[model samples]
Target: MAEKKQWHETLHDQFGQYFAVDNVLYHENTDHQDLIIFENAAFGRVMALDGVVQTTERDEFIYHEMMTHVPLLAHGHAKHVLIIGGGDGAMLREVTRHKNVESITMVEIDAGVVSFCRQYLPNHNAGSYDDPRFKLVIDDGVNFVNQTSQTFDVIISDCTDPIGPGESLFTSAFYEGCKRCLNPGGIFVAQNGVCFLQQEEAIDSHRKLSHYF
Candidate 1:
């Protein structure tokens, strides 16, 4: 006779049946709104505050579009792009919008986040994971900035909130590293810290960035 399956495994399988599909209503971290995922999930949002913040099966385009286009347009003729901490590949999707782009690199500290985004947030990023132009480096953004000899035409910051693992990305030292990674005329655009919870920190970052540029 076949051995009986473990009771723990049976219980775990049963628990999965209780899961309720839901969407993200909204997520406002101390630094920014990380994202609202899922249709009926807790923070999933269909129509947000502006009514313009509409939802789809995917949630990455909004963040990617805003972060990439603004800087690309402002700088003009982006040939190469680097993304710091945008593990979800949202920024990658938007960076590819430039036909002039020659290469794109993203340094995200967490490989798991990239995997999750690819699996769960397909619509948000529009399957950017499969794009050939994207090169994902599962390394610390700070480290990548210091080591990379090649410069970028645009550097978009796609870091997490400051409260957790992403704290250092907002520091002056990281900004210095960012300055080093830029080509002569490259534009560096980051989240700039948060305007609300970290207002003072944001001011300080702005001051630091001004000093660099």
Candidate 2:
């Protein structure tokens, strides 16, 4: 008999939490960082970047719902939306649900993540990519926010943990650029990790966002 393979590691900013991977569906290192899709007995299908758990099949709707609706609904009106990161398209799927939205633009730092997720993580996208009102931009999200003159009624930063290329997405400069990219009375939302899990992420993002917006 052969022993089953088990994967264990310290992931993200969790001091003692660990991920024991049961099965690997895809693993690759893009120019940005290590990307992986694996299945765990408890978590079901999961996506992680640089060893940090990102999205899981079972509980994705909770995160996607909160990240999408609170801002869009609070703003009272949102016709155009911009999504940063979330190459998996989970956020995109939620944003497009609103009939009031006229158009959507998503800027992802790495196209590989998008392509990988689109194939291996098809449930997240939910055919939102085919929507005529949606446009995909594969580029550095920070650069897109800084350069694009277009404005949106709602902006969502569904980014990874603050590390590697995602580091720049949480800076004050990035928030300022995002503010500039928004139309009047616009709502901006970011997926800052839970304070208990990744305290710095939530605190740093709040500090920067407060300074800029």
Candidate 3:
């Protein structure tokens, strides 16, 4: 029998999680970060970036649904939606479910992340990448939000933790740019890392976002 393989999460030095890898699906250093996809019994398939677990096939729906639905439903008649840093396409899948949302613009920093997820983790996207309302723009989220002439009814920032390429997304300037791109009464949502593990990040983000919203 082949020896079992395990994948360890490098999210924190003191506490983390690990998974038994049933199969190594894809692993590579993308243009922006280290990416990996693997199969596991408990989570089905998992995708990680820079040693942090991103999405798993089993429970991705929970995160994506909450991120996409609550704000969109509350806004009631949102037509144009903007998504920043959701290269995995799970956010796209959930947002596309709202028939009222006419347009979805996804700005992802790494094209490689999109490509790999599309190929290796098809379940996460569920063909939403080809949705008629979906548009993919490969660019830094900060630059796109700051420069885009267009505005949106809802903006979802499905970024990673405050590290590496994602560090800039948590800054006050990014929140200000997002504010600039919002139509009247627009709603913006972001993935603030687990509050217990990243209490400082959560606090800092709230402090920055409070200035604009």
Candidate 4:
């Protein structure tokens, strides 16, 4: 019999979790970060980037629904949406559920992340990528926000924790750039890390975002 492989989550220094890899689906070092997808008994298919778990097929709906829907609902009649760094397409899936949303532009830093996730984790995206209103831009989220002339009613930052390629997304300058891309009365929502482990990150983000919003 073969030995089981284990994947350890590297999100926290003091405490962490591990997954039993039932199978290795895909693994690669993309231009931006290290990406890995594997099967687990509990989580179904798991995608991790830079040693941190991004999403799992089992519980993805919980995170994706909250991150994409709450602000869109609050904004009321949001027709255009911008998603930054959701290469997995799970955010895209939830946003597309809104029949009134006429357009969705997802800015992802790594093309490989999107491609691999589409191949290995179809359930996450659920063909939302093929929607006529969906546009996939292969670019850094910060640069996209800064350069785009178009404005959106809701901007969703589905970025990873502030590290590696995602570090710039949490900066004050990036927040300011996103502000520039929002329509008047626009709502911006982001995935800050777990509050218990990343309290300082939440505080810093609040301090920076306060300058713009």
Estimate every model's Cα lDDT from 0 to 1: 0.65, 0.86, 0.94, 0.94
Name the better of 2 and 3 by lDDT. 3
Instruction: Report the Cα lDDT for candidate 1.
Output: 0.65
TM-score of every model?
0.73, 0.93, 0.98, 0.98
**In terms of TM-score, which candidate is stronger, 1 or 2?**
2
Candidate rank order under TM-score: 3, 4, 2, 1
Off by over 4 Å in 2: 1-3, 12-14
lDDT of 3 by residue, 1-213 (tens): 987898999989998899999999999998899999999999999999999999999999899999999999999999999999999999999999999889999999999999999999999899999999999999999999999999999999999999989989999989999999999999999999889889999999999999999
Q: How many backbone clashes does candidate 3 have?
A: 0
| Models, CA RMSD each | 10.8, 1.8, 0.8, 0.9
What is the model-wide C-alpha lDDT for candidate 3? Answer: 0.94
How do the residues 118-176 of candidate 4 rate in per-residue lDDT, one tens digit apiece? 99999989999999999999998888889999999999999998999999999987999
| TM-score for predicted model 4 compared with the true structure | 0.98
* Sliding window of 10 residues with minimal summed lDDT for model 1: 5-14
